[model samples]
Target: MAFIGIDLGGTNVKGILIDQSGEMLRQHYLPTQEDADGAWRDNVRDMVKYLQNYWQKPLTAIGLSAPGLPNAQNSCITFMPGRLPGLEGFEWSTYLGLPTYVLNDAHAALMAEATFGQAQHCQHALLLTLGTGVGGGILIRSELYQGLGQMAGHLGHISVQAHDDERSVAGMPGSLEYAIGNYSVARRSHGRFSSTWELVEAYRRGDPLASYVWLSSVKALAVAIASLSNALSPERVILAGGITLADDALFEPLRAFLDVYEWRPGGIQTEVVQAQFGDMAGAIGAAGFARKQHVG
Candidate 1:
């Protein structure tokens, strides 16, 4: 059987066609014109139609990954704001004339890992995408754990420092997003670094300020991971996004801090690993989800 997955991102709309074995048959990309009066949605619809025709065969399932909370029914995105203006509450299934399952992009990314990437076959796992902002997803018993309002995976918004005054985009005070996300790198570095890359470069050169700022962010991340481990008790924690590219500069300190902050019972600590898929994870994951939902 064939399945289709489309990821609606701020910059691009990525679509993929995959077979039952999870092998991609074809892929396409279209610019996501977020401000072009819902043109992006039309592009997605057209893309799906085009893919359906490519094989001249019926598609077993379809799924969409978008940057918002999917409604309980998975028919539309319910609460997206400030971008993709017409996305909120838009019924994709009705528009496409097909049963289209919708999911949050972050969740879709995790689904990619769970289906075919690093976390494949993992019954309980967690994923964190550390980029412009932090985002994540949870898996419980091999199913995505989308809690009330589909807000369970908004890990970046979790507060790591209760006394700090700075707030994240989600109105969280001293959230993990603010501590390590690229959005707050400048402020965290006192205007010395505009990006995490620059800060890491300086730290490589033994810059004191850079070392302090970078280590501090890593420490906050460790604290967040430790707390999450205590609550979720996942066997593994998968890290994704551009930030993980920092390699040892990020992981080395994060591990060191985890040793200090994490409360591992019986000395069994959760394993931390990087994600396998990169930019295409969301689309692939959406397809994986569609396959699962379709088969059931």
Candidate 2:
């Protein structure tokens, strides 16, 4: 049997066809066309239909990975303001003509790891996707933990600076996202850099301002991670997304800060690592999620 996973994003829609063994059989991508009226849905439907027709085997199930919070039943995104028009309250099963499981993209990323990637064997793990903005997912007892309103993994919205006036998109003041996310780089650095990569480059050149700003962001991230570790006590933390591309520059300072901030009892500390998958994680994870739903 085969499964189809669709990852719907602001810029693109990615779909994958996979077999029972979790190996990707076919993959495709299409532009999201945000300005078009309900055209993106047609594109997604076409993509899914193409994948289904391309594979000769029986199609077992379908899954979707998308932005915003899913409703209690996971049937649709209950609230997704400001983007992906017509996505909110849009039921995939009704549109796709198949029983479809829908989940937040971040949760789907963790599901991918849990189903086949680094967290496959982990009873407890955390995944943080640090891109334009920070997002994350949680795993407890090897199961994805999507709390009330499926809002459990909005880790970046957690505040690291309580007194700061800056507010994140989630209405969080001085959130971890604002401190470290590429979206706020210009505001955080007083216009010195437009992107996190540029800031990291300047820091590499021993630019004092760049060093101060970048290190501050890393410090905030460490504090947030340590705080989360205390709360969740996961076996490991997997970091993904573009910001992590900073490599040693980001991890080195982050490690030092974690050493100071983390409470390692009996010398046991939560391991922090990089994610194995990249841009395709959501689509792959959606397929994995669908397989689980189908088998159960």
Candidate 3:
């Protein structure tokens, strides 16, 4: 049977067709568009239709991984900040004409990593997606944990700075996202750099201002991660995002600061690592989730 997974983001919509064994057979992508009257729904319908057509047969099911909290009962979207307004407030299955399971992209990312990526076989793991905003997911005993309101893993919104003006997209002050997410980094840059890469490059060149801004963000992440380690005791922490590609620049400082800030009675043993699936995790996880829902 072929299942299709749709990963909806603020900028791009990615869909993939996979078989029972989870091999991607065909893929589709489109930039997200918005309309006050919701024409984007039709565009999405067409995208799914095209994916099905590419498969040359009816899809077994469709699954969606999208931004924000899934409403209780998981029937529709709730607070999907940073997503297009047109996709909000609707049951996706209604528009797509398929059996669809909607989950938070962060949750879906964790599902993918735990099942088929870096955190495979781990009993406890935490995944943080560092993108336009920070996204988080928790895995316990190999199972995804969705707390009440499906908001258990908004790790980016955790308050890290006590005296800062930066607020997360979630409208909370001094949030981890505001400190580390790309938007937050850009905001802190004060237009000195047009892109995150430029700021990172400035840091690479040993520029003091860039160093201060970038390392401060890294410090915030370390503090937040340490704080969480105290509470959850995850075996490993998986950092996934466009920003995580900063490689040594991010991990080196993060490791140093993480060790400095993380406090444990015996010693914090969690290892921080990057995700394996990169950009495709959300779609793959969404597909896996749909397949599980279909089977179970």
Please write out the lDDT profile of model 2 over residues 1-296, one tens digit for every residue: 89999999889999999998888889999998878999889988988989988996668888899988999877888888988888999999999988888999999999889898989989999999999999999999988899988999999999999899999888999999999999999998999899999999999999999999999999999999999999999998999999999999999999999999999999999999989888989998989988988664
Q: Cα RMSD to native, each candidate? A: 1.1, 1.0, 2.4
Model 3 lowest lDDT segment of ten: 34-43
- Candidate 3: what lDDT? 0.82
Clashes of each: 0, 0, 0
Give the C-alpha miss distance for residue 294 in model 1, angstroms. 1.7
- Please give, for residues 48-85, the per-residue lDDT of candidate 3 as tens digits: 88888888887878878887788765656787655567
Give every collision pair in model 2: none
Task: Show the colliding residue pairs in model 1.
Answer: none
Tens-place lDDT per residue, model 1, 1-296, is 89999999999999999998888999999898888987998999888988998868878878899998999988899998887988899998889987899999999999999998988969999999999999999999999999999998999999999899999888989899999999898999889999999999999999999999999999999999999999999989999999999999999999999999999778899999999999999999999999988664
So what's the TM-score on candidate 1? Answer: 0.97
Models 1 onward score TM values of 0.97, 0.97, 0.89
Question: Distance (Å) between predicted and true CA of 69, model 3?
Answer: 2.2
Q: Who is ahead in TM-score, 2 or 3?
A: 2
Instruction: Quantify all predictions' global Cα lDDT against the true fold.
Output: 0.93, 0.92, 0.82
Position 191, candidate 1: lDDT: 99
